[model samples]
Target: MNTLLAEPGTLTTSPIRTQQPTGPRIEVTGRMHDRFDEILTPEALAFLADLHQRFAGRRHDRLADRMRRRFEIGNGRDPKFRDDTASIRSDATWRVAGAGPGLEDRRVEITGPTDRKMTINALNSGAKVWLADQEDATSPTWANVLGGQISLFDAIRRQIDFTSPEGKAYTLTTGDMPTIVMRPRGWHLVEKHLTFIDSSGAAMAASGSLTDFGLYFFHNAQALIDSGRGPYFYLAKLESSEEARLWDDVFSFSEQHAGIAHGTIRATVLIETLPAAFEMEEILYELRDHCAGLNAGRWDYIFSIIKNYRGRGARFVLPDRSDVTMTVPFMRAYTELLVKTCHKRGAHAIGGMSAFIPNRRDPEVTARAIEKVSADKKREAGDGFDGTWVAHPDLIDAARAEFDAILGDRPNQVDRQRDDVEVTAAQLLDVHVGRAVTDAGLRDNVSIGVRYLESWLRGIGAAAIDNLMEDAATAEISRSQIWQWIHQDVRTDDGAPITRDRVERILSDLLSTVERFDGDRFDDAADVFREVALKEEFPTFLTVGAYSRFLVDLA
Candidate 1:
C-alpha cells in the first residue's frame, strides 16, 4: 500500500494501484469487498474524477461563503431575503421540469439507508417514493457506501431478493414499487476511500456528494430512463441558489454524457437550512430545468436556526428538543411559506418527516406512533402539502389514509396555490421563547446525543432510540440545543441552570444507565458529544467534526 500526504488538515488515503484503464488518475484506498468493483468501475470513477476537476473549486467556494455567512449572522446580521434575487422570485413564466413518470402521485415516501434489506423493504413499502438516503441516514463507512450502491443496482434490476443467515427470505412485494429518489451526501463531506489526483500531482479526498451522485447516475441513469422513471434525486443540505445552480450544471452535464435528453433528471430540493428558507424561489429557479419540487426538512431546519442564531441572546435560544414541534410560531411560518412558494411556482410542496417509528413488541408504542403519524399527515394534507414522509414502513398506511382523504382522485394539489398565505420576515424570525425547558429535557438531549453518536460510529446512521427514529439531523439538534442552553444560561422548569459541569455530570451518569447494544462505543461517543455540545465555540455540524475524528481515523 502507498499513501502520500497532500495538504495540511486534509485526509490522505492509502491506495494500492489496481487494474488501471480510465480517463484520469484515481485510486481506491478502501479494501475491495464482494462485487464492489461493479459499482466502482473504471469508467464510472473517471467520470467522477472529471467532475471533481471541473467543479471542486466551486464547491469549496460555496462552503467558504457558508462559513462567512454564519460568522456574519452570529454578529447580528439578520438572515432575510436578499434584494439581489428579486427578479427570479417575481418571474412566473418559468416552471420546473415537474414530476416525471412514476413520480406523479407521491402521497407517501419512506426514508432509510440503502442497505440490501432496506432497499428491499423500501421498494415493497407501499409508498410512492423511497428516499434512498446516502447522507444523514447512512454511516458513510467504506463497506456501507459500496454495499448501498450494489443493493440499489440489484434492486433496480429486479434481482435483489435474497435469504438471510437465519433462513428468512425477503422479496419485493408484487405491486407498484416506490420510485427511487436517491439523496447524496452534502457537499461538505469528503469520501476518503477514493482519492482524486489531478494533473498537478495533488491528491485530495473525493467529494462525497459527487461520489454518491456520480456512481449512481453513471450506472443507473440510462437504466432508469429505459424504465420511464428517469433519474430522480432529493438534494439535501443546500444553503443557497448558487449551490442549486451547481447541481443543475452537474445534472445537465450528466444527462448529455449519458446520452439522455436534457431535463431527463428531476430533483427535489430539501429547504432545510435557515439560509435556504430565505432563498427558496431562487433555488427553484436555478434548478428549474431539473427541479421536481421542494421538501420541508423540519429537523435540519430547526438545527439550522439553532446553529446560525446560537449567540444572538435568549430570544433566539430554543426549548427542549421534544418541545420544538411543528406547531410553533416560527415553524408554522416555515411550512406556510414553503407550501405557498412551491404552489405559486407550479412545484410540489412536500411535508417534513414524522419520526415516530413503530415498536411491534409494545402495542401502546405502536398505537402512539399511529396516532401521531396520522395527525401529522392529516395536518400536512389539510395544509395543501402534496405528500409527507414516514420513517417506518408500518406507518405508511396511516399516512397514506390522510392523503387519500384530501387528495381523493387527484395526483397532487399543486393547483391549490396558497395565495392567501403571506409570510413576513418578522414571522419567520419570530421566536416564541417559552418556559418549557426542564431537567428531564436536558438529560434527554444528553442521553440521545451520546447514544446516537455511539451507533453512528458503529456504522449505523438511523437508530431507534426511545421508540423514535433518530438520524444525524436529530442528533445535531440534540447537541446544538445543549450548546445553546449552556451559552444562553437557560434554566430548566425546576430552576436548574444549564452549565458545562451540569451537562457533563448528566452525560457521565447516562453512560452507565443507558441501554447497551452491540458495538457500543460510549466512551468515544461521550468524548465527541462533549466536544461539540460543551465546547464554547459551536460546531457547525456534528457529523463534520465526528467524521474527521472517528470515521476516517488513521488507526
Candidate 2:
C-alpha cells in the first residue's frame, strides 16, 4: 500500500473548483434566502445572484436601527438590565486566589424530551426548564409535528399526563416538572408544515424564514402572555451577538405590544454558528436581563465551521474527522469564557447536549456509557455549567441524577448575582482573529482560527488548541494551523487505528500543558479526558464529533 495518498484537501467531490460567496451576504427585507436560492447551487455565481436578489434594494441599516431602538440599547447596553460592573476582566488573567468550595454544591436543571407523555411529565417535573425541541430530535414529517403542538397545549392546560397520542397511559404530576420551553424550527421547511396544517397537504402560510419564524413565534407568545402563560423561547443557531441582540429587541417589542413588562420575556441562545463564538459576551449582555443561559451548540457549530470555511477546498487538511479535539485549548478557552461570563452576570452557563446514545441492546455498553456521561456531566457542573441537554430518554436520568447529586438542597447556590464582565473589541480580536500563523501551517492552524475567529462569531468564545491559553496573556500566534501541517505526515503514518485512547492522549497532553499554568483547574479538567477515553467502545461518538459529551460530561 502507498504510504502517502491524496491530501484530505485534494479529495474533491466535484471536478471543478466551485465558486463560493464571501461574508456580509445580503438579505432581502421580509424575504427568505432559501426562496431566492431554491434554484441555484452553492457555487459562486448562484451566491452572487442570490446576494443581488436578497440585498440589492433592502434596508439592512433600517432594520438594525429599528432593532436597536426596539431593544432600547442606550449607549451600548440593554435598557432593561443594569450592568453589575462597568468593566469586564481580561481572559484567564485573574489569579485563583484560593481554592474555592468543590463546585458539586452547584446545580444544573435540564428539561428532557421523553415520549410525548414522558416529555410532558418531565416538563412539570422539578427540572428548572424544559425545551420542547422541534428540530434535530424529531422526524421531519407529520406525526411529530402534531405531537409537538399537542404537547405544548397539554402542558399549558396542565393536562400532559394521561395517555400519549398513541394511547399508552402516561402523565405529568404538577410539582415534579420544570418550566416548559419551546424550541421550534427556524425559518425552515418545518415552519410551513407547523403554522398552517394544509387540508390538501399544502401549507397555507408562506415558507418561513428566520425573520418570519420570529414573527410567528412572537405572535403566538403574545397570545400566550395575554392569556397569562409565560413568554419564553430558546433561540437556536445564533450566528452573532448582533443576531442574539436582534432577538432581544424582538422579544422586548413583542412584550410591549402585548401589554407585558419589557423584561418579562426570556431567551436561551444556542451558539450554533461559527460567528457567534467570538461575540458570546456581547450576545449574553444583549440578552442578559432575560437570558436563561447559553448553550454550547456543537453539531451545528461544527457543520458551520466546515461549510463556511473548509468547504472551499475538497480535501481537509486535518487527518480523519476523529483526529479533531474538542478538549483542545481553543474549546477550553471558549468554555472558560462562557463560565466566567455567566458567573460575572449571574446567568447560568448551560453545557451543550451529550451525543452519546446508550445502546439499549447491550446492558454493559449502556452501563459504561451512563457512567462515563455521568462523570462528564459532573465535571461540567463542577466547572460551573448549570445544566445540559440530552437526546435520548435513557440518558436523561443519568444527566439529571448527576445534576441533582451535584446540587443537593442549595437554593441560591448558583452565583447569579454579579456584575457584567467587560471585554473590549481588541481583547476579543486578540483571542481570535488577531492570532497570527504562517501559510505552511494553514491546515492545523485552521482549528485555531475556527475556535478564535469562528467561535467568537458564534458567541461561544475561542475553542481551540491547548497551548493557546497556557499563559495569562493571549497569544497573537495560532499553533494549531502550523501544528496541523507539520503533523500531517504523522497523522497518516501507517496502520494506526484512530481510537479514542489516541485522541484522548493527544488532547490530554495538550490540555495538560495549557492547564498546568492554572494549577487545580487543569487537574480538574483531566476527568473530562478520562471520560472521552472510555467512549472508544462507541463508534458513533467518533463520527459525529460527540460535542455534546464535551459539555454534558461536566461532572
Candidate 3:
C-alpha cells in the first residue's frame, strides 16, 4: 500500500482501497506530498466523494440557471424580489438563527489568505474576526490549496507558527484570538487535482468549494467545537437564493454526517451580484437555520452589474470605478437594502472591505487613507451595519473605532432597525448616478488588471497596489469595466469613444510598463487579459481559463 502511493505532481490512475462503503472511487490527480496525504486520507476522500456524488448535478443545474438568467436580463428582463418568496419577506415573525458561537461580535474583521504567515498574523491581528480566505485572497495552486488546509488545521489546535527566512519568529499570542470564518472558493471553480469516478466509469473534477469546506470541516469542525468555536463560513459569489439553498443543504448533510448538531455551521452570504441584491430576503430565508448574516461585497456587485448589463446600452453604462462611491443612489440602495433585510431577519449586517494598507514611510498618505476608511466605516455603522471588513491589521483599529462608537458596550448593533430605509427595484438598478467615464480611468484599469493577472499567474492572489491591498475582486472589476466600456462604446470625459483598437493599444502600453517578478508569466497573463476583455462572449470568470492553462499540476 505504501509503495502504491503516488508522488507529488503525478496522478494515481487507480483508486486506493478504503473502509467506507461503495460509492464514487476517489483518486488523487495531482502530486501528493508535504503532508497532503494526511488531509487526503482515505477517510477524508470518502467524505468528499459522498458530497460530490450527492451535489454535483445540482451545482451544474444552478450554473446553467445563472446563464439563462443572464441571457434573460440582457434581453430586457428586470430583476425583482420573487413573488413566490414574497410571503417569506412579509412574514415578520420568522428570523434566522443568529450569531452562532465566536460570531456574536464581528466589529473589526480582517481578511487575508490562509498561508502560514497570514494565518498567524490574522489570528493575532487584534480584530474580532479573521476571515481566513481561500477564495479571492488565495491563488489555487496545488501547494496553496493543500498548504492552507494544513495551516488551518494547525491553527485550530494552537500548534501553528511561522519564521521568516531572515530568522524572525512569529507565534500566536496569549490572549483572545480573532474568531476564524473560512471563505471557500465560489461554486464555479473546480479542484482538478482531485477526481471522482462515478459508477458509470465517467470521471469529473471535484468542486473547489466542497474540497475546501469538506476538508476543513471534516478535520477541524469537532476540534473547533471543543475549543468553543463552531464551523463558521463566509459564502462568496452566490447569485441567487437557490445557490444559498444548495449551501444550506450541504451544511446540513455535512453536520449530520459528522455527528455534529444540525445548526452547527453558520454562514454569512456575500450579496455581491445584482440578482442576489434582489433576492437577499429569499437567500436568508432559505438558509435561515444556518444563516449568520449578509455582507455588502461592493466590488463584486459592481462587476456583476457590468457583466450582466454591458450590452443593455447607455442606461447601464457605468462611469469611472473610483467615482462609483457607495453614496451613489444605486449602491446606496443595495447596501441599505442588505442592512434592512439582515436586521429584519435577525442577522448581522456587515459592510464592505476597506482595502487600504497603511504605509509607514508616508505618514501623510497613511493619514488620508485612514480618514477615508474611517469615514466609510462610520457611514456603515450609522446606517445600521453591525460590523465591517478591513484588509490590513493597521486599519482594524480605525474600523473598530467607528463600529465601537456605535456599538458601545454591545457585541453588535443588530437591534438598530432601519425601517425608514425603503429601497425599490428601480432605485437599485439605477446606474446613471456616478460620474462619466474617463481615459485616465481606462488606463488605470488596464494597468491594474495586467499587474494583478501577472501576480495571480505567479501564485500570488493578493497584491498591494498603490497602497491598497487588492485581491481577485479588484482585478475582476477592472477587466469587467473595460469589457463593458468597449461593448457599449462608452465615451470618455474627453469625448473619445471606447473601441477594441483603443483598448488593445492601452493594454499594449500597460503590458510594456508591467515589470513582473515572475519572468515570462506576464506573456501568458497578457494573452488571458485580452481574451477575457476583448472577446465577444464574456467569460464567467477570468480565473477559470487561466487556472486550467497555468495553475494545473504538472509531473
Candidate 4:
C-alpha cells in the first residue's frame, strides 16, 4: 500500500491520537465530557473546521437544489434518469475499486449504534461487516457522538470490551472480526455542538457528515490501511449524483491531505431516496474509483417516496408500513434495478435490514419472525444480492445461511449480472397498494411512531417494539404513512376515513395505557409525532426538528 500519513504515528491499545490539522478556530457549544479529548482533539477539530470551510457553500447549494427538485416533483414531475449523464451509465468498461481487504465476503452484515456493548457484541456476532452507525441508529447527543468515535477507535485496535452494570462480561471473539464500515450522518444534518466561523466572520454549524468523516479519517485512515483494512463508509440519504460527486471530492481531498493513496477509501451509497433510485448507475459512475456498491435502504426509500408525493394526490399514498414489503411491485423494481446497476458496474449490491428483533419471552413468536427473516434473505440471495443486514445478533446465522447456500465458496455474486432487469420511471412510481388498509394498520402506525419517538427523545435511536427493530427510518415511514393516509382521504377496511382527529385520539389512548419508564418522554414524543404527522407541510426528517428542539444542550 505504501501510504504515508501527514504525521506518522503508531496505534497502541490506548486511545491516544497523534496527528494535526491547521485551520480556523471552531466554537464547540456542547458540554465537554471526560475522555472526549481523544476523539475531539484540537487537530481533529481543526481538520473538521477546515473541511467545513472548504465545502460549506457547496453543501448549501446542494440543499437548495434539493428543495428546487422536490418542488418540481411536487408540481407534477416524475423523476427520470438524467439525459446529461447517460454517457457515464452507458460506458461499459468502467468499474469501481471493488471489495477492499476484510470486505470480500459480506454475506452477513450486522448494523447498530456504536455504543460500547454493541461494539463488542457485533464484533463477536460473526457477521462479515459491522455497520458502526453514527447516523439514524444513533441519537447525536454530545456523549453519543464522541462515544461512538471512541468505541470505534478502540474496537479497530481490539482494545474494546464491555462489562454490564450487573456484572455481565462481553468481549470480541477470537479469530476474524467483521470489517468496520462507518455510516456518518447524511448530507442534510449538522453537528450543532461544533461551530466554525466562516470568511465573513459569521459562525456556522459544522456539517455532521463532514465532522464524522473528517475526524474518523484524520485519526484512523493510516492505521486502518496499515492493518489490512481501508477506511470504508456507507453513505446514507444521498439524493443525487451531484451529492455523490461532492462526496467523491471529499474522499479525494481527504486522501491527499492525509497523505494516503488515492482510492484507498471505499463507500457504498444508500439508494434510499426517490431521486437517488433514478440515478443509481450515475451515482456508481461518479464514485467509480471509490464506490464499492449500493444498498437498498428500503424503509427510507419508502419514506422519501411518500414525502415527495405527499400532496400529489392518491397515487403516492403508501398503504400501511406493514403492507409495503420488498416483494411489492414498486419496491421490487427498485431493488432489482439496484442489483442490475451494481453488478454491471462491478459493485456489490447489499440488501436492506431484516428488521425483526428476537422475542426471547415467546419462543413461538421468535421462531415465526426468524422464519420470515430467512425468507426475506433467501429472496435477496436468490435475486443476486451479495449480502443483507440483520438488526439482532440472533438472526446473523440465519441471514448468513441463506447467502451461504447461494454463494457457496464465492466471495460475492457481483458476477451475476441481472441483464434482463429493466426499470422505467413509471415502474418506479407504481406505489399503489390496491388492497384495503386496515384499522389495525392505522393504529399500529401511531403506536410505533410515538413509541419510537419516545425512545429517540430519551437519547435512544434504535428500539425494539413488537419484536421489530424500529430506527429512524422505520419511524419516518410510519409517521409519513399516517400523514399520507389522512391527507389523501384514505379509508380503512371498515370504511372509516383516516383523519387527523382519529389518529390523535389513538395517540391519546395509547399514552393513557402505556407504561412509562423513569425517564420516558411520551408527552414530547406525542407532540413531535403530532407536529410531523398531522402538519400540512412535510418535514425532511423527524430528527432535524426534534434534535434542535429537544436534544441540543440537553439538561
Candidate 5:
C-alpha cells in the first residue's frame, strides 16, 4: 500500500494499485466468503450507492430544513443566528452518559497502543476506563505515518488481552481489560480502524464526526451497518437545537437503511462551545428522541469562549485555564443549568473532564489532588450530573466512587426549577436583569447570607477571603449561595429524611457569625436589596423576614 504522512498528525494511506481477488483465500475456503458477503449485503450496497448519489450533488438542504422546523425560534432567539444543522444518529447503543454511580471515581487513561508499559500500567491500575487514543494524545510525528495508525490499532487489539509486559499469558475477559474506546482521527480514519478491528479479533466502538452534516455520518453509519456492528457516534461541537434535530432525522434515515427500529444508533453530543450552551435546552428537547446524554467539552469550550472575546477586545474577560474553573457564580449557574436542563428533559447530564492526574512520583500531592477531584464530583452529583469523565486511567475508580456515593441506586431527583416550575419569558427577563444583578434580589440575599455564613461557619467575613484566585468580588457572592441554601427551608412535609429545620439551624449560626465580622457589609447588602425591591415594586422584605423567622426558630 502507498503511504504518505500529513501535518496535524494524520496518517494517509493510498488505495492499492491492483485489486485482490474477490473470493476468499484457499485457507478459509467457503467460510470466509460466507461471512464477508453476509456482512456486506446487496441492500447495504444499494444504500451506499443512494447515499453517494444524493450527497454527490450537495443534497443536505432538505435535512437542514427539517432540523430548523423542529427547533423553532421565538422572541428571545438570536436574530442573526442561521439555521445551521448537522446530522447525527439518535439510536443510542451504550447509555449516552454512564449510569450506576461512582462516575467521579472513574478515570480514563489514554495510552499509545504501542506503549506496552503504559497500557499495562493503566490496565493494572484501578481506573475504570481506558481509551486507547489514536487521536490527539499520540505524537504527531508517529501519527503522520500510515503504518503507525494501523500498527497501533493492531497492537491494542492484540495485546490488550495479555496479562503482563513480559508476555505472560493470562485469559483476559472484556471486563478485565479497561472499557475500550478508540478515539480515531476522523471519518477518513474509519476504513483503516474498522478494517483493523474486523481483522483484530476484538470489539470496539467508533467515535468522532462521520458526517459533518447528515451526509458524512450516514456514510459511516452505512459502513458500520453493513459490517453488522451496532451503530454508535460521538457528536462534536454541536451549537444549537437545530443541530440536535438534524441528528434525530439522521437516526430516522439510518433505521430505515438498516431495517432497524428507531433508537438503534445511540449518540452523545459534546457541548463545547458558548453557542452550544445557550442552545442546550433546545438541543436536548430536539434530540432526546435518540440522545445518550450531553458532555461538557471543557477545553474546546473555554478556548472558543476566550478566543471570541479576545477578537472583540479585552473588555470581555474569559478564564485561561480549565483548572482555573468557572467562577463560583458562573459555575453555579452553569452546573445548575446543566442539571436542570438535562433532568427536565429526562436525559443524563454528564460532567466535563478533570483532565489533570496527580504526578505519580509525588504520592502525597497526587493523593490530595485526587481527593479534591472526588469531592468535586460528589458535589456535581449533588447538583445533578449523573456521570463524569477523566483523561487519566488512575483516577477512574475514584471518580466512579464519588458519583456512586452521591447517587446511590435511586433514579435521579429532578430539580424543582426543572420539573415543577415553568419559566416564562417574563420570568427569564426579570431574573436576568432585575434579580441577578441588583442588591436585595436573589443575588443580594445570597451575597448577604454568604458573608453572614462565612463569619458563623468558617470564622471569616466574605470580604476577608478571596473567592476566586484573585477576583475578590466573587468571594462574597460565593458565601451568599452557600448561606442561601443553608438558611433556606427545604423540608418536605411528606416525611422526608431531612428537614428544613435542620438546614435553618445550621445556616443561622453561620450567618450570625458573619454579622459580627462585617456588620457594615450587611448595610450595603440591605441598601442594594432595598433599591431593587422598591424600584421593581417587588415583595422583597416579606421573603427575607420569613427566612429570618424560620432560620432563628430552627437554630
Candidate 6:
C-alpha cells in the first residue's frame, strides 16, 4: 500500500503502488514520462480501481450478451426492437437533459486525435464544437494514451502551445474556442498498460473506457465546471440501451464522487451500431438525465452491419465501401429514424462525418470536395439534424453554411419533429440496394485496408488516403467489406469471383506498393489484414488484436 508521486518535470518509470486492503492493487505498467504523475496520481488510480471493481463484471456480462445476440442473428433470428423496452420507447413525455453551457450551438464539430498540433488547430477552427477523439482517431500506444491526456489538460486551461521541429510556433486564439467533447474508447477494447491485481494475485487489464474517462474526469471535471463548462462526452460504439444505462450509472457515480451536481455531465451517444439503431428511443430514455443527443455514425454503422451479417447469405452482402453513401435507402432510413426518435425525445439529432480533407493544389478537386460536403450537410440540415461532424478544419465553412441556412438564428433544429419518417426494421436491414460490386472497388478496399493498418501500426490512427481523412472506421469498413465479399463469393463486374487466392494476390500487390513508404509495418499490417479478412471466423475488431501485439510493445 505504498503510494509514491513523482516530482514535476521527472518521469516515474516504477509502477504506482496502491494500499487499500479491499480494493484492487492498481499498477501503471506503462513507462511514465514528464507530467505523467499529474494525471496518474495515486488518488486517481484508487478512484479508477474502485470503478473497475464495481462495474467490470457488469461490463463483461454485457459483452457476453452482445455475443449471444450476434449468434442468434447468425442463426437466422431477425433482430427487432426489444419487446421489453417497448414501453420505454412509447413513453414520449420523458426527454434527455437539453444542451448545457458550451454545447448549446454545435452546428459544426471538428473531430481528430488530441495530438498537440491537432489540439491547437481544432480549437482554433471556426466550428462550434471540437470532438477531441480518443477512440478511432488515436492509436492506443501508451505514449498516445498518456500524452493525449496531458494535451487535453493543458488545452482546457488555455496553456497549450506547440513548436515544430522547424521552429514554427502554434498557439490558440483569444476568443471563440470550440467547445470540447471527449469520446472514449469502445467497450471491447482494453488498456493493457494499466493492470488491476486482486487479493488472490489475479491480474486483469483495465477497461479503456474507464481508463480514458476516469483520468479525464478526475483531472479536469472540476476545472471545466469552474470555467462555466461542465464535463461533456461523446459515447461511441454502444450496441444497446443497457450499455447506455451503464454509462448513466457511471456518470451519476462520478458526479457524486466529484461533489458535482447529479446531472451536471452531458453525453451525446453515437448510434453507430446496427442494433443501436433499433433502440435509439430506449437509449435516450436510459440516459435521459445525462443525454444531450444522438449522432449518426455512418462509417461505423456500416461496419457494424457487415460484422453482424457477414455470413447471412447474399441478402446482407454490401457493395463497395464507396458505394454506401448517406443517401442510400437503408442509411437514409437510419438517419431519418434517428432524427425522429431524438426529436421525439427532445434530444439533438447530430449527423454523420464528412471525411473529405481539402486538397488546395487542385482547384477542380477542391471544388468537387466542397460540392460533395455542401450537399451532404444540406441534406442533413433538411432532414432536421442539429449538427454535423467534419474531419478537417477546411470543411467547417461548408458545413456551417448549410446548417446556418437551415437554423438561421436558432441554436438547433431539435424542434423539427420528423413525424413523416417511418423506418421499419426491414428497411434498416436493407443492404443489397446500393451500387454494384466492382473489381476496382475490391482493389481499392485492399489497398486502403493495408495502408491504413500500416499507419495504425506505426502509431498513427487517422491517415489521409486519397484526400480523405481515414480512421479506424475506414479500415473497419474496408476490411469488413473484403471479408463479406469473400464469404459470399461475390463476383465483381469484371466477371471474376472473389476468392481468398485473389484477395491474397491483391494484398501482395498492395503490400509491394506500400512497402516503399511503410517500412517494417507493412509486413505486420499484411499479417493482421490476412488474419481479419481471410479467416473463416471474422475478428470482432482489428484493433483489439493489433493493440495487444504491436502497440503494447511500445511500452
Shift in Å, residue 201, candidate 4:
1.1
Cα lDDT tens digits, model 1, 159-262, are 89868889989998756678999999998899988887776767788899999999999999888878778889999999999999999999998888888889
| Lowest summed lDDT window (length 10), candidate 6 | 2-11
What tens digits encode model 5's per-residue C-alpha lDDT throughout 1-555? Answer: 322211112223334423322221101111122123322233333333333333322224433542353233211232222234222222223123322222222223333332344445555555544544333333222122123333333333443334465867543234344433333332212222121111223322211222122222333444434443334445554655665665566567667865676765655566765556656666765766566556665555544343232223222232112223533343445456666666655566667655446666678767876886687677766666766766455567777776667666644443323443332322221211111211222333344434433232221211222111111113222332222322332122333322334434433544465535544444443333333222223221122332232212110
Using TM-score as the yardstick, the better of models 2 and 5 is 2
Q: How accurate is candidate 5 locally (lDDT)?
A: 0.40
Model 1 ranges off by over 4 Å: 2-24, 553-555
- Best-first order by lDDT: 1, 3, 6, 4, 2, 5
- How many clashes would you count in candidate 2? 64
Better of 1 and 2 by TM-score: 1
lDDT (Cα, tens digit) per residue for candidate 3, span 1-555:
221122222323344445322436566768777798879876777788778878888999999999999999999998887898888888999999999999999998999999999899999989999999999999999999999999999999999999999998989995788899999999999998877666565678889999899999999999999999899999999999999999999999999999999999999999999999999998999999999999999998988998888889888888887888899889999999999989998999999996667898999879988999999999999999999999888898899899989989999988878889899999999888658788999988887887888888888889888887788988988898899888877889899988889988988787677664636577787899998888898888889999998999944
Better of 1 and 2 by lDDT: 1
Task: Give the TM-scores of the predictions, in the order they appear.
Answer: 0.95, 0.52, 0.95, 0.95, 0.49, 0.96
lDDT (10s digit) by residue, model 2, range 57-115 = 22244335434542342133322211332332334332211111121221434433323
Weakest ten-residue segment in model 1 by summed lDDT: 4-13
Off by over 4 Å in 5: 1-208, 211-230, 319-323, 411-555
Give the Cα error of residue 464 in candidate 5, in Å.
Answer: 36
Clashing residue pairs in all predictions, respectively, total 0, 64, 3, 0, 33, 1
lDDT of each: 0.88, 0.43, 0.87, 0.87, 0.40, 0.87
